[model samples]
Target: MTSNFRSLPVIALLTILSLPLVVMYAFTLVDSITDAEPGSLIPSEFTFHHWRFLWDDTTGRGSVWIATINTFIFAGSTAAIVCATSLTSAYALSRLNFPARRFFLAGVIILHAFPTITLIIAIFLILQFLGLFDTLIGVIMVKAALELPFGIWVMKGFYDTVPWEIEMAGVQDGASRFMVWRKLVLPQVQPGLSALLIFSFLSGWSEFILPLVLAPGSDAQVLSTYLAYFLLDDSLEVDFNLFKSVGLFYALPVILIYLAFQKKLMNIYGGGSKG
Candidate 1:
C-alpha cells in the first residue's frame, strides 16, 4: 500500500503534464478535418474543405510542389556536403598530428558562434562576386557553412570515443591507415554519423532566412518563401486551416525523415552493437 501510494504523486504529475498535450492534440485533430475559423479553439462545422482546397491547383498557383522539391534539394545537398566534409575533417582533428590543431578547432568554435544571418549582406556580396547569388548553389553553400562546425564537433567526439586499439590491431595486421579508417573507424562511428546527419538535415531543411535572401527568384523560391506568399495575400487571404495545410505539406518530408532516423538514433544511442 505504501509503495503504491508513493506512485500517486508521479501519476498525478503525469496527468497534469498530459492535460495540455491532450487538449492541443484534440484541437489539432478536429481542426485538421474542419473548416476551422481563425482564432477559434473549436470548429462550429466540421469539414474537410481545407484539405481539398489545398490541392485545388486548377488555378495553377499551388506552390506546394515547388517548395517540396526545393526543400529536398536544399536539405539533401546540405546533408551530403556537411557529412562528407565533417567526416574527413573530424577524422583529421581526432587523429592527425599537426601544429595549430587547437587553433583550428577554436576557429571552428568561433565560426559556430557567429550567426549566419548577420553575414547576409557580406555573403551576398561575395556570392555576387562569385556569380552564385540567387542560385540554389548559393543557398547550399551558405547552409553547408552553417552546418559544418556542429558536424565537425559531433563527429570528432564520436571519433574520440572510439577505442584506439581497434585501429592499432588493424594497423598491426598490415592495414594502411586509410584502410583501417575505412573499415574500422567509420563502422564504429556510424551512430554519431546518424546523430550528425539528422541534425544536418534539420539545419537546412527548415531554413528560411538564408534561402529567402539567396533564392529570391520564383524558380529558386522554397517552402519558406512559398508560405510567405500566402501570408502576403491579406485581402484575398485564406484561413488558418489553409495555413495549417501548408505546414502539413511542408512538414511531411522532414517528419518522414525524422521517423526513419529516430529508430536509428535510438539504436545507436542505446549501445546496440555497431553495424
Candidate 2:
C-alpha cells in the first residue's frame, strides 16, 4: 500500500506528460471515422468514406491490400533471414576461435555505424547491375544485409551469456557440435531470439526510405511507400481524413505486434553483453 502510494506521483507525472499524445491519437482516431468542416478541428458527423481505400484503388497507384501483402512479405522475409543467419553466425562468433575474429567483430560494428542513406546510391547501382533494381526480392536482400550487423552483434551478446557447460555436456554425450547448438544453446537464448525477431520485423515493416527509393513499382509497393502517395499527389485536393485513416491502417499491425511481444522486446537489453 505504501509502495502504491509512493508510485502515485510518478504515475500521475507520466499521465500528465502523455496526455497530449493520448489526445492527439484520440483525435486522429475520431477524425478518421468522422467528417469535419473545413478549417474546423471538431468532427461533425461519422462516416466510413475515408476508409474506402481498403476495398477501392482510390490512390490510383494500387490496391491497399497489394501494398499490405508486399509489406508483410518484405518484413517477414527480412525477419526470417536475419534470425536464421544471425543465430548461426552469432554462435560461431561466440563459440569458435577463428583467425581475425576480433577484426571481424570490429568490422561488424563499423558496418553498422554507417547510415543507410549513405549506402543507397551504391546499393541502387549494384541492384541495377544485377538486374534487381526496383524488385521486392532485391529490396528484401538489401534490408536483410543492412540489418545483419546489428542482429549478429545482439545475438552474439546473448550467445555469450549461454554457459559452456551445457554445450560441453551435449558434446560429451556423443552429440555433434551442430546438435548441441541446435538443442542446447538455441533454447537458452530464446528470449534474445524472440526479441530480435520482433525487432527485425518491426524495422522492416516501418522502413520507408528504402522501399520508397528502391522498389517504387506498384507490384512491390509496401505500406510505407503506399502511405507516401497520399502526401505526394498533387492531382487530388488534400484529404486529411483519408490520410489519417490510412496512417491508422498502416500502424495497426505494428501496434498489435508491439503489444503482443512487448515483454520480450523489453528483454532485448537485459541479457546482452557490453563487449
Candidate 3:
C-alpha cells in the first residue's frame, strides 16, 4: 500500500507526458484515413482513397505489393539465418574453450565497429562478381551477415547465463550433446533468443541503405525503398496523407510483431541461471 502510493505520482507524471504524443500519433493515423485540409488538424471528410493503392496498382508504375513480398522474403530469411547460426555459434563459444575464442569474440566487435558504408564498394563488386547483384537473395545474405555479430554476442551472453549443470544432467540422462542442447539448454535462453529474432527481423525489415544501394530499381525494392518513392514522386505537391498511410502500412507488421511478443521480451533482462 505504501509502495503503491509512492509510485502514484511517477505513474501520473508519465501518463501526463505521454498523452500528447499518443494523441498526436493517433491524429496522424486519423489524418491518413480522412480528407483533411492543409494545415488543419481536424478532418473535413473521411475517405479510403489513401489505401486504394494497397489492393490495386492504381499507380501506373506498380503497387507496393511486390515490394512487400520481397521484404518478407528478405527479412524472414535474414532472421532465420542469423538466429540459427548465432545460436549454435554462441553455444559453442560459451561452452567450449578453443584457441582464439576470446580473439574471435573481439573480432566480432571489430567487424561490427566499421560502418557498413565503408565496405559498400567492396561488397558491391563482390556481389557483382558472384552474380548476386540487384537480387533479393543477395540482400538477404548481406543483412544476415551484418546482423550476425550482434546476434552472436547477444546469444553468447544468454548462453553464459545458462548453468552448465543443466547440460551435464541431460548428458547424464543418456542424452546426446545435440539432444541436450536442443531439449534442455535452448529453453533456458528463450527470452534472449526471442529478442534476437525480433531485432534481426526488424533490422532487415527497416533496412534502407543496403537495399537502396545494392538492390535499387523497382524490381528489387523493399518497403523502405518504396517509401522513398513518395518523397521522390514528380508531383508538384507532396501528399502528406498518402505518405502517412503508406508509412502506417509499412510499420504495421513491426508493431504487431512487437505486441505479440511483448511478454517474452521482458525475459530478456530477467535474472539468468543461478549457477
Give the best candidate by lDDT.
2
Q: Encode model 2's per-residue lDDT on 1-275: one tens digit a residue.
A: 35635787898999999999999999889998999888888888999999999988867988999899999999999999999999999988999999999998999999999999999999999999999989999999999999999999999999999878888999999999999988878888889999999999999999999999899888899999888988987987788889999999999999999889999999888984332
User: Looking at candidate 1, what is the lDDT of residue 261?
Assistant: 83
Tell me how many residue pairs clash in candidate 3.
0
The global Cα lDDT (0 to 1) of model 1 is 0.79
Clashes (N, CA, C under 3 Å) per candidate: 0, 0, 0
Please give, for residues 43-155, the per-residue lDDT of candidate 3 as tens digits: 99999988876887755436689989999999999999999999999998899889999999899999878799999999999999999999998889988999999889888
- Largest TM-score belongs to which candidate? 2
What does the lDDT come to for candidate 3?
0.86
For model 2, what is the error of residue 199's alpha carbon versus the real structure, in angstroms, after optimal superposition?
0.7
Q: Which rank order by TM-score, best down to worst?
A: 2, 3, 1
CA displacement after TM-score superposition, residue 210 of candidate 1 (Å): 1.1
Task: Assess each prediction's global lDDT (C-alpha) against the native.
Answer: 0.79, 0.92, 0.86
Q: After superposition, how far is residue 218 of candidate 1 from its true place, in Å?
A: 2.3
Encode model 1's per-residue lDDT on 149-256: one tens digit a residue: 988987888888778888899999999999999998898888878777777887788899997788877777788777666666565555666666666667777778
| Model 3 worst lDDT run, 10 consecutive residues | 266-275
